[model samples]
Target: MTNPYAASGVDTEAGDRAVELMKQAVSSTHNNLVLGSFGGFAGMIDASILKSYDHPILATSTDGVGTKVAIAQAMDKHDTIGQDLVGMVVDDIVVTGARSLFMTDYIACGLLEPTRIADIVRGIAKACKAVDVALVGGETAEHPGLLKPHEYDVAGAAVGVVEKDKILSSEKVQVGDVVLGLQSSGLHSNGYSLVRKIVADNNWQYTDLIAEFGRTLGEELLEPTALYTGVLNKLLQDIRYQNKFSTMSHITGGGIAANLSRVLPAHVSLDVQRSTWQPQPVFQVLAESAGINLFDLESTWNLGLGFAIVVREDSAASIIGSLRELGVSSWQLGVIEPKPENAESKGYLSSAKGTHGGSVRLVGEYAK
Candidate 1:
């Protein structure tokens, strides 16, 4: 009465039950644009929507949650990690000023615990619904021999559409652009390898009560990443802001300067003023514990800002004001200018990500 596949390792029944438990949450994210029902081998979305565009360009991004998953596993928490996944994947699509259409996730785990798998997908569905992106389909792969039962990883791909002319990039950057920063919700989903190292070296428990955070260390670290798609897309939809912005930077693994460099032209140089903002308490604590200087932190953590928008200087006030109204704490982080003559001597990084781009440097000191 035993199937050979089940006998070997894969649990077909558990996978099915995980799908069943996650069906409602997943279906909740789908709109009429999502064609076909769940359980389809390949997900379908109505591409006819693109006909309305003059020149619709598709933007696709794939990303994983990274070592932050270790914290989730350590705390036995899975729900909030999905938002991190959505933020890592869909936000990249939105960086191109694209409207996210749909997303698919893949989970690789040694054993498929139906409830745990359902929790992860439910989180993904919740985040997708927030951004109005359909959760069309997903897969859960069981790797019994390669991974332990409790060990797993999550990644996803997002699809979005933007008019060709509206695509934001470094090519649109002009002199005197105002660089605005969007606040992040804790560490988001990057640099957790170092975060874990700090925690382990200090022998800190995930449940350790830290006064600065006012919550357990694990809760603070596991705080869901902020979703920029909904807010950024909302800003893009407003006619008043048309053609006022050039490019955006999503501060992830590369930190502020490196990621911002990804969207800059070769001739531009930007010095992100650290005096404009202070590192969050969590960052401060980690830095103090690790005895590393602010520069090292800058290369790893987001510090405070999670996303940045480079806009025309004239629109700086209005854009930051709009972000405030949208409940996003934003500030003028810096300005774009002609490349400084002393950029190389000043240690500006133009090719941090290995692309031919503008130079960026973190200058001054973070406000105390």
Candidate 2:
């Protein structure tokens, strides 16, 4: 009898081999709470930690590494991509004031290269350990004709827990609250499609940028996504300061203005001072070389701010100071204001403090 799976270009044997190679890499990330083995369809996590709360809200987010994967392929590095995968999803869940508990990944490829798959799993393990989450299980499919022989895509799903009363939603945000900007590790995966075009147009090789990074362009581009687990977990631990932090936003595909607007209530608007922060040099280089408009830069990339915390006016300094103490570069970026009465208004009604001694107005459509 002919094997239908083989005819379809998926080799079960190769898939098995890939799993075997990734077993150790995945197991290394397991802690006391990981249940069963590594091949389960769904990961099982011991959620007894949540028993203490009267009502525990489970926050789950799924995301891909985006076109940043192309850079990884160009650089021939796969390890850090998994961390980027986990970060993209986990950070989004955490914005709701949740603590990541467990995560799983999905890797699909036209052909399974055991070593490359293992490298990716290893990266996921490293990131899970840093965030104190266990990697319970994941899937690796080997579909020989579905993808380019050497090309693959990766995505992830993360589960987080937050006390029922502790979810940081827009409802708590109010006028007079201060916006705190947390510095990002350059680019952080989004806007890479534009980045690649810029790099190609400049006639600049990845090698040209590697010198500034003290590593190869691939290594720098694959730099693991920064984990905010510990810092946020610490801040959420203080019950007295719970209400002080009214809203949190993870700046991802949408830049600051877009993401922040998501957490703003109908009656409130965010006023960001651009001069309050400096865009990372990589962004500047890309903008100058690619001829990307400033508005596009602000709308697409994070512009160096990855995470934002909206806190009461009085708690702003303390939050910034605390983040600094934890080795995170954060600053007061702006404040919340009453939304204009005219619903048709498309502006911030105010501007960000720019680095050039001028106000920078918000130019993108708010995230609805």
Candidate 3:
């Protein structure tokens, strides 16, 4: 018997198969702390672990994969996008020194493609396992008419817990602190809108290779965001980094200047040296081919540095050395200086400050 719903592009059977395919991957993220089985209406995580803290504060963040999914779809790659989703969501929680507990993902698509759905979930599960976050539950919505058959969007939310007093923020950031830059794998999920625009303008296919990039454009663009949770979590436990690690700025949508400004106080300013570390090849290529000015490029992309750490001046070398031991490359970009009360700091202060924003200026020239 032919199912009437199948004719409309929605298949309950395929949905079931997708769940069946992803069950093992999802279950692998669970530990004794996760309650119940894989399929559930709501994810159950044991919060009893929080009792270990004097006062545990829960941190939650949700984010989508953005236009980067378009690149993934162009090349028929689904796995890495899920990691991008986790990187966008979970990494934000840990920015406040929170240890990620569990994550849930939502997938919306035109039809039920079990293999594709499973591939996405597998990527999320692999990332969750790497950082000890439980993948408790997820929803795959089959939007039959709204999206094209191969079109889908991925978003995820993560929950974490941190001791009340141990929470990290800009409040801890002070003048004389050293700012360290964490090297990114590639673009790390931002600036994709401009990336796609550039590719379209240049008539470049995902499979096309540029001499500088070595691999196909799709391969470089699809490089998953570097997950920092595991390493940062270790650093948080060490006494040397305890108070020295004041705050962090996850270089995302607004680039280095805007993001660091979020964690800087009004009285302080972040002076970033552009030449301290090399900008990734992708960003340099985009600037040369697209004719994007350095400042405009900084506003749009991470420009190689993914995450910024603010620490005491004495601790910079120790922190940088520790991060290197963990395979995370870092650069000592600049320092936190007092924000001049008058207009003398115009060029040094980035005007992107919000109420909490501080002056952030990029000094020095790009390392050509």
Q: TM-score for all predictions?
A: 0.98, 0.88, 0.96
lDDT of 2: 0.76
Ranking by lDDT: 1, 3, 2
Which residue segments of model 3 deviate by more than 4 Å?
343-345, 348-354
Where is model 1 more than 4 Å wrong at Cα?
none
Task: Judge candidate 3 at residue 342 and give its lDDT.
Answer: 63
lDDT of each: 0.92, 0.76, 0.88
Per-residue lDDT over 68-115 for candidate 3, one digit per residue giving the tens place of the 0 to 100 score: 999998999898888898888888988999999999999999877999
Task: Please identify model 2 stretches exceeding 4 Å from their true place.
Answer: 1-11, 209-216, 343-346, 349-368
On lDDT, the stronger of 1 and 3 is 1
lDDT of 2 by residue, 1-368 (tens): 77787877777776777678778878877888888877877788777878888899999999999888877777778888888887888888889999888888888887777778888888888888777778887788776767887788998888889888888987887778888888898888788888788778776666565444666655665666777766888887867466798878888876667677666665676667777777766666677667765556887888888888888898788877888898889988777777665533555422222211111136333221
The residue-level lDDT of candidate 2 at 200 comes to 80
Superposed Cα deviation of residue 144, candidate 1 (Å):
0.3
Backbone clashes in model 2, listed as residue pairs? 272-352, 273-352, 273-353, 274-352, 274-353, 275-353, 275-354, 275-355
What is the Cα-based lDDT of residue 364 in candidate 1? Answer: 90
TM-score of 2: 0.88
lDDT measured at residue 122 in model 2 versus the true structure, 0 to 100 = 87
Model 1: colliding residue pairs: none
Against the true structure, candidate 3 reaches a TM-score of 0.96
